[model samples]
Target: MNKIISALCFSIVALSVVAQNNPSINQADTARQQRETDQVLREVGPGDSVPSLFSEEDADIGPQTVLRKKKPTWFRGTADAQIFYTDNMFFQDGNEQEAGLAVTTVEAALTTPPCITRFASYRAEVGYRHQFFNYFGSDDVLAVPGTILTRRFDAEDFDFDSSTAFAEIVAQTKHYQFRAGFDYTRLLGFEPLR
Candidate 1:
């Protein structure tokens, strides 16, 4: 019957769509775990040395607490003491002039939550970043390259400030994770930020 054939076609198409989407749901969470496993495998099996940054015996785990922390991990520090400067490089536009821009960003995190078995745990992270730019362009043009103008000023406005901040809560188990966060961004448009 034609109705049966039509139903079969629709079912095939629906199955195909679901099959395509299911892999991506698992891909993102599994990616980090797979990389960690590969790093461990390479270090132990091939004599490839990967430095263990933290001592294993120092992990803090409570016997009576809800979490069973067999392995505790923690790291927090920053190592950078340098200045950066950049001049006009040129992307594309009629606006042309020398420029100066500087960017400085700092972030840190501490994840020491105990585990609720081999399958579940809670984690949180917080970070912030900021950037600034000062681009001065010329709108004055002379009839000749060396010709002088009585008074010159550019009639252009430029974007000169940007910043972003983020905080995330990550609760995860063996096969899945739930994440919630607040993200604030100030990285758009040429309007002056006050």
Candidate 2:
């Protein structure tokens, strides 16, 4: 009698579990959830938009942002050499000395890409230049020193080389333009005059 009672209890519990997990019960809930999702998508429409903190007109108040698709920077250089004759080596009106000389000039620069915007355009550059003067027949002539008629010097005292370093910024607009720059030059062979 105890065995029969236990078998009956087990069968009742198994049937109750099967009824709770039936497919028909889940089908109705799935259909209701799918309908709600479709209704939400229809109400939102097909277009997409992003929310922004500021309006379009408010963005134009301060300095405008410069936009460049491609920034191109370049390194540039130039060299020049010339041989010339000068009748006045010292550039004196009373007594002019004649000489033959060669001049060589070299320049190099590095420039940043131009920054352009709706209101203005600007660029920055740094450069260096060197010039050398060689006097061939200058030694044959005599140079008069400053304020001393008795003192005479060789023409080689005027032969000198110079080096210059510079930096510049250029800016332009529709109605106005501006430029700012500075250059420093050093003479290599002018100590005798000092």
TM-score of 2: 0.49
- For candidate 2, the lDDT comes to 0.74
The best candidate by lDDT is 2
User: Where does candidate 2 have its weakest 10-residue lDDT segment?
Assistant: 44-53
Q: For candidate 1, write residues 79-135 as lDDT tens digits.
A: 333333333324335433444433444445565554444456777777665554444
lDDT of each: 0.54, 0.74
Where model 1 places Cα greater than 4 Å from the true spot, the runs are 1-92, 96-100, 108-122, 134-159, 170-180, 187-194
Candidate 1, residue 58: CA error in Å? 20
Candidate 1: the clashing residue pairs are none
Q: Candidates' TM-scores?
A: 0.31, 0.49
lDDT (tens digit, per residue) of candidate 2 on 27-105: 9877776656544543442343222224673455633332332337578789999998989987888668888888889
* Cα distance off (Å), candidate 1, residue 164: 2.8
Tally clashing residue pairs in candidate 2: 0
How many residue pairs clash in all the candidates, one count each?
Answer: 0, 0
Q: Pick the candidate with the highest TM-score.
A: 2
Root-mean-square deviation per candidate: 14.7, 25.6
